[model samples]
Target: GAGVSQSPRYKVAKRGQDVALRCDPISGHVSLFWYQQALGQGPEFLTYFQNEAQLDKSGLPSDRFFAERPEGSVSTLKIQRTQQEDSAVYLCASSTDRGSVADTQYFGPGTRLTVL
Candidate 1:
């Protein structure tokens, strides 16, 4: 399916390590989003981009977390100085449109990160 796809579906990192996750959104999609989910918790928004511009990053846990959509089609999320608290599933989503209350966000399978 030409929806959203993420790479490195699973990751294991020791504390203080760095990890990168990838996302490939549907072609022509304009809105991209990243979210984090802790065990037994719902996903929480991390950041969002409109095309190649980052519009919001208020949800990032700290400065150590970063995300970018260089060409607006593929995006990456990086976590530096990994901590046990950072262990969670990173989810990427894309919407064909943005700013409409009815717009639907399509989500990728997600990349689970486990930090020890």
Candidate 2:
């Protein structure tokens, strides 16, 4: 029953502040993703990582957004110079890659960030 979990379920940040969100994925999952969900829109992919390598990051909004999985288990999303538009729910999802055509992703509760 491995599950993904995020920290600081809620966060408040100043307009120009920097914030770091953490995500702990299911143990042994090789694929990880970071998503951002706005007020009314569905979750948008932000980044993806396979093991410790960042395979795709084209979905990231700006250079201010960054995500990393150093040891391939725990990932961190860092936002610098946060803006009001940056306020959203950050979600973490992970899936296993065991020679399967399709892997089901398990998502975390998400960390809601508010930039005032």
Q: Pick the candidate with the highest lDDT.
A: 2
Decoy 1 TM-score against native: 0.95
Q: In order, what is each prediction's RMSD in angstroms?
A: 1.1, 0.9
Clash pairs, model 2 backbone: none
Off by over 4 Å in 2: none
- Cα lDDT for residue 51, model 1? 96
In order, what lDDT does every prediction score? 0.94, 0.95
TM-score of 2: 0.96
Candidate 1's residue-wise lDDT over 1-116, tens digit each? 57799999999999999999999998999999999988899999999999999999999999999999998889999999999999999999999875576678999999999999
* Structural similarity to truth (TM-score) of each candidate: 0.95, 0.96
User: Per-residue lDDT of 1-116 in model 2, one digit per residue for the tens?
Assistant: 75899998999999999999999999999999999999899999999999999999999999999999999889999999999999999999999978686889899999999999
- Off by more than 4 A, model 1: none
